[model samples]
Target: MKSKPSGTLSARHIVFFVIAAAAPLGFAVGSIPLAIGRGGIGTAAMFLVAGGFLALFAVGYVAMTRFVPNAGALFSYISAGLGRPLGIGVAFVAALAYALVSAGAVGPFSVFAEQMTQSLFGVTVPWPVWAIGGVVVMGILGQLNVELNMRVLGFFMIAEVTVLGVLGLAVTFQGGATGLSLAALSPSTIAQGQIGVVLLFVFAAFAGFEATALFREEAKHPVRTLRRATFGSIAVIALLQSFVAWSIVQAFGATVVDVANATPTEMFAIAARNYVGDWFANLITILVVCSWFASISAFHNATTRYLHALARDRVLPAVFARRSQRTNAPWVASLTHAIFTLVLIILCIVAGLDPYLDLFVLGSVPVAVSIPAMECLTAIAIISFFLKDRRGLSAWVTYVAPAISALALAVVVYLVLANMEFYTAQTGAINWILPGINLVVLGLGVSRALWMKYRSPRLYEGIGRYGLE
Candidate 1:
């Protein structure tokens, strides 16, 4: 007989997977501040408020780990808890969000790569070339074994934390001319307005944490280990991010003005230079390029596995279920995702977009739409898990946690919409229509699900009742 089919990932793998997903740590802390800096002291307050909201969002998210244990993440959880149509909507948004984020990174990665190449070799390459390179790397790495990706992510995670800590401490000891100020935390500053802008940044900061649910089937102990890893990932990310935000305010002074004034794309280089000196600053820039790539790689790798699972279940095309002979990786899905990334890279470049700002906003918008929906669905899942069992003690995880998370995320979504103007400078038709545009995209996904249900009821129900391929 053929060897027994392989099982999902181990518990240790689950833990390492979450930890590796931390590559966005540097980008989140460094770049987000620049987005809100135009208003001066309001920058620090924005960071604090955004960070707080994210922490709240995490509370309910972590709780869902107990009920919905699957690596397909929001797509799987919501479908299982709610119905197929809703799940399909959520899955479409999730996939769009990941792809958008990766596409947006193309600009930043190219910019950083160009910066590094120029500094080291005294040569500059076209940004598109670097973008294409990123696509290749993402595809190759995504096709590797999950365990191997986690190991690579682990090293990047440690490097990210260590660099951030060292920089934070240096800033602490130096004591800037203005020093740190609590005024940055003032309600007057945070409440001054721009709810959409603030929420958008906050949501982006917490982007990939939901990927934790995607690791459940892979976990050694799916129920316990997945729950712990999911919650633990959220907690760890919050703490580390809070620390970094505090350091930024401390280093620049609570009222440090002119942050949005950083004309260069590598704004973080300024912070690194001020906090860690020139030699280290250069190193930090290089590390940032790696960090961005790692984020893309981690997402690319995990997402393809989800496609593989969905394919195996016959929800997606059977091609996605194919495994590489050597790596046992999901071959077709990984390449498909890569090709999509490359196309996005080309389109973004052709649009003459500012690599940094354009990428950040485009990458962020889909996530702002997808994540809250996931939270709401996850809440539904939690309730289902408890109702099906009638357990007395699960009130917190199943009911309370999901409720809080869903409520907080709903509020966050509202805030993001209200403050959209603060984010993109897009004016006229683009500004008026962009939000509607995203909704249209979401609506299309819903339509696709309906079509599938009608066209192939059996497969659709299999996806609905069982899960995606």
Candidate 2:
């Protein structure tokens, strides 16, 4: 039998899925500081700004969800609104974007796992060994029911948030290194350093925004669950991230830029040392590893789901569509993702690539660009979908909100392109080449879809349909 959703998941469950996918501790230790180094204290506000914009995007997105419910959210949404051929093209991009993202998470998970283990227990393990180990664990989990996955993610998430709470509150109560200051949130202080690159970091935090839609088929009251989960995830992360950034600011006070620029990746470590203690700093490092594992698991789920959706429609081998009836796991698709992860890690290792620099950033950052671009395309498709009939949705829901989202996301795509070096950490041919992978795959998908349209009408009609009820 074809794999089917268990239809037991809920909004709260999906929220964990989304938040864990974004990996809060990992971002605070990683991306947030990068933004601070560029934008000064005002960078914190970008969290709320990005959240509000996504919430607005969700208005039309959720409406479209009710209008066209399916598991392959981006794929089905585009197909329902636009035509199937274009939908297939975007589906291919979305699939590649997410698979690349999943593999990207593995590289760093391995790196930090190696670091964390060696530091905590004084046992040395090679990063490539740790990388394969992560794939094995995540692959097994990916083949189980999502509830089990949520539980595992939930434990790590709680630990992450609890530790983060300590950092923020400790920084506040301790009156900071230079006294408590609200300047980071002040409207007067704007992001000044390479604003495009800074905002790219901010927008990328919401990368898992599509998680809500993708799990809808399994969600009870899918539309209601989607609306609540989408808004809830964005709001939670925005507020949590802002609070964390505020703490980091308080920890360093005016020296935020100097510290961030000097250390880059050590922002969290430095802050923990200042306000909390070395004990807390060490704990943060350990949790950072767990956080990355959560991220890998979350993205692994997304990648496998994409494979299952495509495989079920014959865009891929049908064997990949098989699922565990008892587990509700896309077992075959999960295996496919595990194999891809293994191959990617091996290829990077063979090339003697730095896991974080050459592997993750190159593989993952383009996803930040391409997914937002795909989202822009989906926003436009929503307008097109509702063009003939509003379905009684307000002009705001059908047109206005979507128009704003499309324009904003289009601007985002441009920003990523303009500041490619800042985002990818490379110059010259490789920078463009990394981003070019998205376009090349996009063209290939479009071409194959056109071929199906002419040569196999039956298959063309089924693209992205996914047996949605």
Candidate 3:
């Protein structure tokens, strides 16, 4: 018999997963101050709308932990519940989503790095330098075993949250000239167009929480631990963001819209000075670098594991399935992810993309696609998985939950396509290129499935019955 894989992960490892995922939360809080000042506090409604989708998505996601625990995530679910063709389709899109994330981050990271460097050293560097450095460092860290990386991630997350908490309190105490108010909490606020925009922001905030479940096979007590982490992360981060958004509104009141509109960068700086004086604000600037780094690390780890699962399934090369003898890690897959990330970073820099907008948009597309698509597939998977038994699962989780999730994803997909122009790249290719890439990937999957259907029907059938038979 084949030797069982070694180096299982434990629940304690979740702290690192959380840390790697924490950037979504931090970026939400940090970026919201600016969006609120510009777009109006009404944008806060996006939180509720997007958060609802997340809630629906989580139900099926957590449910899957008990049945199918693997890093391939969406791909794995589809293969087990649906068939090989669908599984391959998911694998293709999932990879596209992640690759886009690394590509998209390049731009913003450059801008963030440029600004921070200017602030501290009074020297300027090319935006690409900072972006490339982040890519490199994330790759190196990803090459290491998960346990050590988790500890480092934990430290960064603590710093990120602490800074935000400090800013929230300071804004509360100083009180904007107009004072805080509950006007933003009204239903009318969500009714506004800001809800649409805010939904995008909220989606961005919760981007990496799915990464937690991606660690299933590695984790001890995979089902229980993954569920707890997934649910706990969503609840904690969502509530915390609501509080932070409220604090921001309280700090600026009506002026929150104006500030977010005119001087976006100044929002954090102003809040920092008010909360802890100039020195602390400066320190927060440094923490931004660390925050971005931690986020990159998280993505690196997640994407690598995803590749590992694909490799194991024979979707990619078998070489990708190789593990590190020293640490019992997916060494080749990690290196591949690193190299892929590096190449994308370099390409974006060479292409002269704007760091902030470019990276944000790039990251947004896959995120917009991945979670919703994964959730929808998982939902459908639930229906199919239980088609034979249908006895143990709750109705909400089995049917209503996934249906609502599918509806939400449909809406999101519609909105993304409709507003593709809003987040398009400088090359003017996003409108065509991004969606085109996903389509091509799906086509590749179909082609492969057809070839297998002709060449190795038995293996193809094996893929179809992957987990659920």
Query: In model 3, which regions exceed 4 Å deviation?
Result: 1-12, 22-26, 37-39, 359-366, 425-429, 464-469
Provide the clashing-pair count of each candidate structure. Answer: 10, 0, 11
| Model 2 weakest 10-residue run by lDDT | 1-10
Ranking by lDDT: 2, 3, 1
Residue by residue across 1-469, what tens digits does model 2's lDDT show?
2233448888888989888888888878888888888767777877887787788788888887766656778877888888776777788888888788878988778888898889888999999999988889988899889889988888888888899899999989999988987888875665444567667888877888776888877887777888899999999899999899888888888788898889988889877887778999999999999998998899888888887887887877789889899997999988888898889999999999999987788788669778888888889999999999998879999999999988988987898888888777667997788778888888877788788789988987877755455
Ranking under TM-score, best-scoring first? Answer: 2, 3, 1
lDDT of 2: 0.83
What ranges in model 2 sit over 4 Å off? 1-6, 467-469
Give me the overall lDDT of model 3: 0.69
In TM-score terms, candidate 1 sits at 0.86
lDDT of 2 at 350: 96
Higher-scoring candidate on TM-score, 1 or 2: 2
Which pairs of residues collide in candidate 1? Answer: 9-218, 10-220, 11-220, 71-214, 71-215, 196-419, 309-469, 310-468, 310-469, 311-469
Q: Pick the candidate with the highest TM-score.
A: 2
